[model samples]
Target chain A: MRKRDLSQFFKDKRVILLIILILASVISISTIGIQEGLDLKGGSLLQLQLEKPVDQDTMNVVTTVLDKRLNIYGVKDVKVRASGDQIVIVEMAGVTPEEIERLIGSPGKFEARIGNESAEPALTGSDITNVDMYEITGTSWTVPFKVSPSGAQHFAEAAEGKGGEKVYMYLDGKLIDENPPTLSPELANGKGATELTVTGGANTVEEAEAQAMAVYTVLKTGTLPVKLTVIGSNTISAELGEQFLNGAIIAGLLAILVISLIIFIRYRRPILVIPIIITSVSEVLIVMGIASIIHWNIDLSAIAGLIAAVGTGVDDQIIITDEVLGKNTDNTKRRKTRTRMSVKNALFIIFASAGTLIAAMLPLAYVGFARGSSGIGTISGFAFTTIIGVLVGIFITRPAFAKFLEIFIK
Target chain B: MLEKFMESYKLLIIIPMIVVILSVGLIAFNGLNEGIELKGGSIATIKLNEPIPSPVLENQLKTALNVDEVDILNNNGNDVTLEIGTEVNPASFASALSGKGQVISYNSIGPVLSDEALGQVYWAMLFAFIFMSITVFIIFREIVPSIAIILAAASDIIIAIGGMSLFNIPLSIASVGAILMLIGYSVDTDILLTTRVLRRREGKVVDRAKEAMKTGLTMSITAIASMVVLYAVTVIFIPQASTLSNIAAVLIFGLLADILTTWFMNLGMIRWYMEWRT
Candidate 1:
């Protein structure tokens, strides 16, 4: 090959575009960041199937109530949405599945009864306006709550003549406080006092704090409208999630290194191997960037899909390289014609294979979406990431690599 | 060089054909072992602060939890995986393990949902196969070559499944994704072989086949190399990535199977078709 203008080659639009895209992808990945799924980040995912099918409004109510309950539990990154007519999906980051089950598993019917256990509830969670923690002593705490106007009147009347009697608290038909607090004689004439306190039953400050917080959460967010059965739940520990993140990064880097070594050994030419490996690596980066921009969650399956995409990507690059550089016995004139034909043939196979791969993964993505929050939902992340990676390879990275090969390869 | 064996292509294809048939037979008779995700069950991984024997934990789980089916898998020396049937309660199950170790992760699925999931997985595989076959037929537009491509893809899946059964890898959603992906990977090399052998007329048939083999082998080797790295990393360093490890395992097996089905079986059919056409 004659001496080509290297600077002009750099000026080619495809190469310039490739460089710009790589830079943009790096920036996007650093700034926006890809979302990690529960598997990659320690969290909990719960799929709740309702007792009966409900309308859109009821579903909305359920979602709102659940969302409020999780928020009250101080789970900031909680997502609760209706999947179908009878299913609700709840996802919380940095929380255990057991914690989620405890918080939302029951209807949380919190009531405070006066006099006897069989007596009617003087104040329910719905009658409470606000719930807050109060320090009763050095290590003891109480959950003080303010009732609504009508509830305050009912409570005062119930406690008017029963100053020494106990005011019992029950949550879901089970008495939460074993030793109920007795009414004081200071306000015995039914003077409606809205503020009341539930004594904490714990030995340490931390335990009292936790008990107060649980009570506050239940009182703040009213009971769920319908019963929910947890059909599926997945929880990962924070330590394990961090380990997976680090391990995945190392594995990805090693995979790229090994793949580069293979290509180098096969081609035995830096000119061919460098572009191939660069294209493959760039494909991964661009996919991750797109994932970051779209806020797609990168779980283990998605990571697997990303690797699968790069694997096929390397395969396509090999095909292109072999097509352009494979030996031919024709004369110089026919050799030039053969190289051009081979590139075309290689592209045909690349596109055909790309089509088949996309076709194969289509059902995985579609079925996951169509099934709502069922079994395939978890696997959908893999399918979506794979499709995205393949599409990026065919549309952006592969064409750019072809352009580079055309400019550089002899 | 390969032309000498062209006459024996029929004989060479018989080996893989029998393996495929036996694989189908095994799957039909014994059936695939479904994972907890596929069938409704519970799986918990406990991280032991100290070392404990597997048998000790197993007996404790059985006695304390009263679970009918409990399998304790000792991963490394510190982590133990408990697989229990759906009869076990998730809350109590966690408490039962807490006495011995800290529960690192837990997954539970109800029977009704898992049944629905199983159905979805079957349909997904079926649809993926049909779609891939259609794409291959469209690309080739020839009956023999398209069938060869589809056959190779099918054989890869069947053999991969058989490998899974032999290796005791349970069929999960991750493995299902890998199998579907195998269809894609299998078709990739088959397309390259068919296109190079049937379309290009630069040299003798064997020479063209040999050239295709060089490129196809490189492609397969690179893919296999990457998967090997992935599998090794997951198995050795990252035990939490069990799902991805399963996927990598399936892909490695399928890719190896693809080499035989593509070069031996698909190549045989393509060579016969080319010779008959002339």
Candidate 2:
């Protein structure tokens, strides 16, 4: 047979279509990019269970309060969503588990009291109108706040005869600042002072700043109505997460290389192995592109799923290649008829295998959804990515690969 | 020569059956290790400025924290993970290790959440198995081949669990995902073998079997190679990704088990059925 024309091969509609699809996927991946999960990006995930199952309104209020608190505390990229009936899943990037637990774990009730501890709180967080942090000196930082008219009047009355007496600051009913500044005689005798500064006890500017920020956040968002129990929390470091991302990419490339080597050893024909590798790679790209489009977080498990999908993709391509190339000594019919029959048989096996694979992964995805962000929920990304990969293999890449073989094998 | 081998198909099938039985026995006697993700506990990953021996760290943590169980896992030279039986104050825990390292990650799961997660894992596995079996049955529309495929899948999982038990790998969410993926992979080779031997008539029975083996073995070998690469990369370079490493490890075991079950047990069953019909 004459040498096949490479230009003509590229000119084929199927080949062009495959190239276009692959290009689209690459573009999507580069532009949209896959979202990294908290495990892949240094972050914290807290699964909070409320004390009692409340109505949707109460849950909404709780989520809103938590979101505001995290934002005020300078935690960017905070996601607070209610999962199931009583669970609230809070995910924040670039925050430590200790920081999150301290910030959100509290009911956040802030109160200031004078000498008469038996009387009601002189000023609560709800009474505060504004809070701001200021640098008093090189190393000193204080958070000042303004109270409402009623709150100011209450403070004046509480501090009238309580000059030089200490004012205690409380958070969540616990005495947080026992040495708060005493009420001065001027403030007690003069008009009710609406503004006061609370100096955070710190030896350094950075420490004071952090303390001031925490106080500001608490006073701003006030307290949550319902109590929360931290059922689960995961924190990953930024450096470690970056290492995992790099390692995953290297592993993926190495996997491709090794798989290609195996295929080459088995087939010993570059014509067949090249297409197999390209098809497998395309399947992966398409899966990732779809992930980007759907905003799926590519966590550790998802990466595993991607590898598994590609592994199975290679298996299916091998089956297709063997079927198309298997020769019979006694050919009783035309070559087309024999090839058609073999290809049909191969497709049947591929479909059957794909069906079973889909069946197996379906539960992982759906059950994870039903249970929310629990243990199994972490692996749901794996299941979903695998399903996408398998579906893409069967529907798009495998058929294109078969067509390539049908054109070139003869 | 092929006929002589066909005569002992029953005996050949018994080998894998015995392995499956032994695997089941192993699992029953030595229950699988459950990770903190499944069992409620605290895991603190600390990155040390200087390397500390795992034993020393474990002993220190146990003494300082007064915890019943403290398991220290080293992550190359970068970090070490400590698993504690009860929740402790994160600040205190960090302070206790301040002299040696810094805590990079801390995860804790309460008992209630863990129990709920464990229930979900069980349900996912059960549903996956049932659905996959149904799909296989529907595809073949034949009793013997379909049953062979399902049995092969089960044997692969059982053998994988046995391997994990022997290796002391815990049954975490990641490993469970690997097992579920194994169900898919095990069926791939079995389906290919069955289709080639039963549905096609291009060659003699033994020749067709041999041809299917060539194809199926290539598939299994390629998968095994990729998994090996993945497993090595994660273990050496990304020690923090225990999830990926565990998943790769379980897949490696399951794929190896699949080769045996598919070639010996599944091929033997089909050969016997074909011979009996003739």
Candidate 3:
């Protein structure tokens, strides 16, 4: 066998694709940045399940109210995301799960009073039938809402002879609107109106819209449309997360070193170990880059997925080395054309194996997404990362490795 | 000699089957423990500042929390993971620690959620296995060979579960995830052997099978080596991440089972199917 020069290797499409993807991954990794998952960064993640699914509008109210409540409670750096139509995932750092549970466990409370000195509330959150936010009017934004018949009656009684008095709005017993809408004379004449508006003026249209949205959120957040059950919760302390991250790094390096040793032993060629290790590492880097591009959290489960993927990547390389180079070792019987034939065959095996692995992972990923960042979060991340890893191997890295093995032939 | 090995293929095939049966029996006789993830309770990982024996920490926690049931999932030196029968808030659980250690992580699942987790695990594994079976059939397109591959994968999982039961590895989402991975990964050797023997025309069937064996054995060995190392490192450095160690352990067992199943059972079946076809 004669040595094939480097130019042909660079000219190969497979090698070129691999290099381009690796570069793209590096660029994306630098620009977009890979965000650490909650598991690694040490945060509390709560999966709140609604008793029943609600419309998107209701889901919005659920998230917005949760965000407002946490902020009002002086909780900083909180993120509330709605998953599907029913689940709400709330994540925050430096806050205990117990504190978050205590905060969101109860429904948001809204109270209306004609005066701050009054003891009893004239209206509660349940009194509001609907809050409409789609309509906006000029620099002054007005939020229209319908009140229950009973609520209209209580409001009329509370506002009777209280014209020009400011109606105070409170959410969870904290003052929301310091300068509230004043009770109109007509409404103060002891007649109840089911229709009402929380109107305010702002210097900018954006401010006006924001003001209306705030009031709407306060009112709608008054009571959840459906009961929320804390289905699952986990809290990882910051230092522990740091330790886990470090542990993962160490474990990964050791695994690679040991795997390389195995490859070297099996092939009995130190040079082959270099390419195998490079291809394997390239698979991981590409997976992480894709994860970064997609904003996937590189969590503990995901790291496991990376390992599984890299493990499979090594397996594929082994297959290629054996089929392409092993048959070549029996040089007297097999020809160059035969070696080329098995190379294609080796790739077929890679594709078939990768196909089945991805097939197996689909359901796990689906279930994880269905569970929405809860206890199954670990499993789901494992599934998703494994899928991505296998894909990168079959599509990019394996082909390059196969192409590189060509130089060993002829 | 190759012909003699072929004549005794039945015995070779029976080996993996008997292993699978015993694995089934082992799993049944020694039921795998349900992980806290499935039944709904609380598990707190504590990084103990000082070394404490398992019993001493267990007693202190039981008395401090006044909970009758407490199981230490993992206790590796200063890193200890404890599972409580019921949900305990972080405050009381922290105070129960009595300054011995700091809680690294805490996970709590109510009873209802545990039930949900179990249900999800069932469906996910079921569908994954089904999809994998379908993929294998689609790849091979032959009934007997496809069945052989599927059977090998099933046996691998059963044997792996048996290993889990024997080793006291609980059936949790994490461990179950490892089992599902076995379906995808351990089936590769079966795919290679079946494809080479049934689909390729380069050499004699025995020679093709032998060739495939070389490639397949290397694949399995490399995969197994990586898992062994991963399991070792995980157990040593980060005992708190028992999830990883559990996954690595399950994979190692499954891959070992796969070597026997794929090489003996699957290979024998494929060989018989190939001879019968002619």
**C-alpha positional error of residue A399 in candidate 2 after TM-score superposition, expressed in Å:** 0.6
Model 1 residue B208 lDDT?
84
**Per model, how many backbone clashes are there?**
0, 0, 0
* Residue pairs in candidate 2 whose N, alpha carbon or C atoms collide under 3 angstroms: none
Per-residue lDDT over A1-410 for candidate 3, one digit per residue giving the tens place of the 0 to 100 score: 33345778888898999999999999999999998888788988887888888999999988987888677555667889887787788988888876657457656576778855464787778899987763577877667888999999998898889899888776666665555788789989888889887666677888676556656665655666666878667889888788788988988898889888888787788878999999988898899899999899888888988998898888888888888875564553556667777789998988998999999999999999877777665688999999989998998898888878866544
The chain B TM-scores of all candidates, as shown, are: 0.95, 0.94, 0.95
In candidate 3, list every pair of residues with a backbone clash: none
* Better candidate number, 1 or 2, judged by lDDT: 2
The lowest-lDDT stretch of 10 consecutive residues in candidate 1 chain B is B86-95
For candidate 3, give the DockQ. 0.56
Using DockQ, give the best candidate's number: 2
Candidate 1 docking DockQ: 0.81
Native contact fraction, candidates in order: 0.83, 0.93, 0.76
After superposition, the stretches of candidate 1 with alpha carbons farther than 4 Å from their true spots are: A1-5, A134-141, A153-163, A183-191, A199-207, A327-338, A370-375, B87-91, B275-278
Across residues B107-172, which tens digit of lDDT does each residue of candidate 1 receive? 888886788889989999999999998999998899999999999999999999988887778899
lDDT of 2 by residue, A1-410 (tens): 23464665677776777788788879988998878888778888888889999999999999999999998778878989888778899988876657767778788888878775565677788888888755456555567888888888878877777788777888888766545667777777736888887665667877667666777777778788889888888888888889889999999888888887887787788787788878988888888888888888888888889989988999999998898888522454665576766677788899999999999999999977776666678888889989999998888888788777665676
Give the runs in model 2 whose Cα sits over 4 Å from its true position: A1-14, A134-142, A149-166, A184-207, A327-333, B75-79, B275-278
Interface RMSD of 1: 1.0
TM-score of chain A of each: 0.88, 0.88, 0.74
Clashes of 1: 0
